[model samples]
Target: MTMVSDLFNSREIALGVWLMIAIIAVLFGKSTRSGFGGVLKALFVWNLMSWLAGMAVYISAFIYLFYRIGLWTPDLLKDTVFYILFSATVSMFKANKISEDKHFFLEMLKDNLKAGILLEFLIGQYTFDLWVELLIVPAAVLLAGMQAFAANDAKYAAVNKLINSIWFISGGFVIYHVVDSVIQHFHELLSLGVLRQILLVPNLTLVFIPFLYVLSLRMVYEEQFIMLSFKLRDKKLLRFSKRQAILKFNTDLRGLKRWVNRWNLSHPQTREEILVTIDAFKTQQYLEKAPPVVLPQQGWSPYVAKDWLPDEKLKPAFYDPAYEEKWSARSGNLKLDKDWSGNGITYSVTGTRLAADHLELRLAAYESKKLDELHAIFKERVALLYKNATGVEAPLKLTNAISRKKNIHFRQGIYFISLEKSIWGNITEGYDLIFTISTKND
Candidate 1:
């Protein structure tokens, strides 16, 4: 019974529970199985690298400092605190992308907090210089609560925030006291003056707390994004050339910076690292002289339609009005016509022989807002149909890139596409897509 009681309250038990939560969250959370696997792989790599580098730095720094002071005795408290800074710095230099998915991000938060808690407990067993609970508990609660707020996760936000407030207040009361106590003890041991000890010890540990907080919250999560992207690449789902991948990496870096800036705007250490990623991306060679996007209009030509169906006249077609019903009436300034204006445009064969069949489709939107909506609907529907019927790629890139001409057009084997914009003194606007298809069965 005594053993059972002790086992339940142990720090090892706490760490195990925390790890189990992280694993469950990642596996059943907002990601696919493959994505969760990638996230775990990335976290392991990040932690492994950080641990190795931190141990090396800790050993070298410890040996040099002891030798300089002629003190051969090891100071576990100071050593553990100092080592955290080195480990966290290594993580910063090798930054990773953060995910847009909230589940993956939450899993990373729990995993990192668990790691910190385990570290605090392991180090605490050696030295009772500081209260481990005061440091790790508040840090974990604060990170988890802040993440909930950032993600707008309603289920846990209110409860987390309330509990975090108590822990934060309690932790605040002990932070400086604990650091000072640890510093004072070391000062007496080395016979260092008050001023020197104050400068040497508290500054590093004091600075380390905020770093550890942010690191536990974000860095591990960011690395998972890179792994996710690599997994997509491996599956042939995302096809990108080497140059495109670099460009995409730069974009992800910017996105991660934006996410960090939103949650922890005032963290100077994080801000500096974010700035470094931005500068590095902007200086890339491919992006330096990229051409500005253009949408040009090409005049219509009476080209023979492929596999043309023999029809007496071009058929009338109208744009779907249901797509704009939601936002079309939101602003009173814009008004949509109550009827399909099939007579807005007309087309017919011109030559005497009328040797080739020709067809044209035209649509119109009266309200400026509806014009944008119309464009989106037309593009998506047409792309869908094209993909379904022919098993070919949609022409979205070509459509978006064309210059804004009066009759911008393009033709594939048997289909031609174009759009017309309606403007009335710049106050009212409308647009339509003209698509022609052959009905030949042969």
Candidate 2:
């Protein structure tokens, strides 16, 4: 019969056209660049989804047209474009849209819901393929949920974990039961009038779920993204606090010469001020050597703070003048008294072992407010280098600066160039130096 031949011819043309399109896509979709792999992969997924959807939409439309007209003949271009539009509509529904984006999609969801419902109403329509469109929202939600979990921290983590867990558990059991037991009950109900039963309340309910679920998840995901951003900002301030303290200590130290020159040590309040400054600048308190607060009942981790320190005192360095005196006094030999640096600028921390225990230090004199700062800057840079250096191949040279906003400082009145014979032993006197370099006016 003519109807049968026409059906066969139409199907052949559709198949041949699809094959040709596939060849064209394969040729154009590939790339020559190395970094284009991700682009190609995304394109591949998009096209593959479009291709499958196109074929289904065209075939279903053709069959319905044939039954109505008693013959089949599909225009390749017309059918392909229509199917592609339908596929795009399906893809758009589940795409996660931000608040700024939702205005565009609000109209799209309305259009698709109309098309989906109307397609099922046609008597010979083979549009269970339209139900595939329903999958987009749920898939997007599941994906958005996963992204939320991957990057989650304190606050939103609890809710994100709960939704994903509960959804998986509930959906798995519910969907499986619907397929196994409810399918039979629905089948019996639908046997009377399959088309009407399929298109009505159940399908609307099913379609609505995926749509609402994705939209709700996207909203929560957006809110949490904002909260996480704020938390990271707070964490940034916490980290900056340590760096700020170091900079402040360095700045005050650079002012040493000014303070040393101006200090009225003969004043009535001199001793009391010196005592307070010394206590504040003590090595055990200044450095992390101060015992962390510990809960003895629950032993140690990194969090112990404000722990009590015992026997706080300074230890001698390799070149200490005290050792020369102690050695000379022991034997009946000629002893040389080494002269001290200007204004007693010494600082030394005493500990039996390198780390994993208490640290203590003594400064030359914590008398002048300006001079006391030298002890801080010297200890900060010196102690850091010492702790981190393990048997160095070469001697470590560390620089510390005391900064003034608009000026460079050398703490001592003069930069004494000539002293000891060797460069290592040169520069016996300490001096102030500015750390930061600024502009012309600066």
The segments of candidate 1 whose C-alpha lies over 4 angstroms from its true place after superposition are: 1-66, 69-73, 76-161, 164-442
Tell me, by lDDT, which candidate is best: 1
C-alpha lDDT (0 to 100) for residue 221 of candidate 2:
45
Error of 2 at 288 (Å): 52
State the lDDT of candidate 1 residue by residue for 1-442, as single tens digits: 4664343333334544566877787778766667988866876787657754654565457546744765323333443444455544543443332233335444434544453553343233323222453356546776776765644445765776776676688666556555655566654535433333223323333433334344443554445344435434333322332233344444454343333332222222333444453454344222223422321122112222211212223221111111322101010111123323222322322111112223333344444443544445444444543453334776655456322324445565554544544344434544443543322311
Q: Candidate 2: lDDT over CA atoms?
A: 0.35
Clashes of each: 7, 10
Name the top TM-score candidate. Answer: 1
Model 2 over residues 116-207: C-alpha lDDT tens digits? 55333332122122234245335556767775765444566767677678768865654564455444565454542444333333332334
My TM-score estimates for the predictions, one after another, are 0.26, 0.21
Error of 1 at 127 (Å): 11
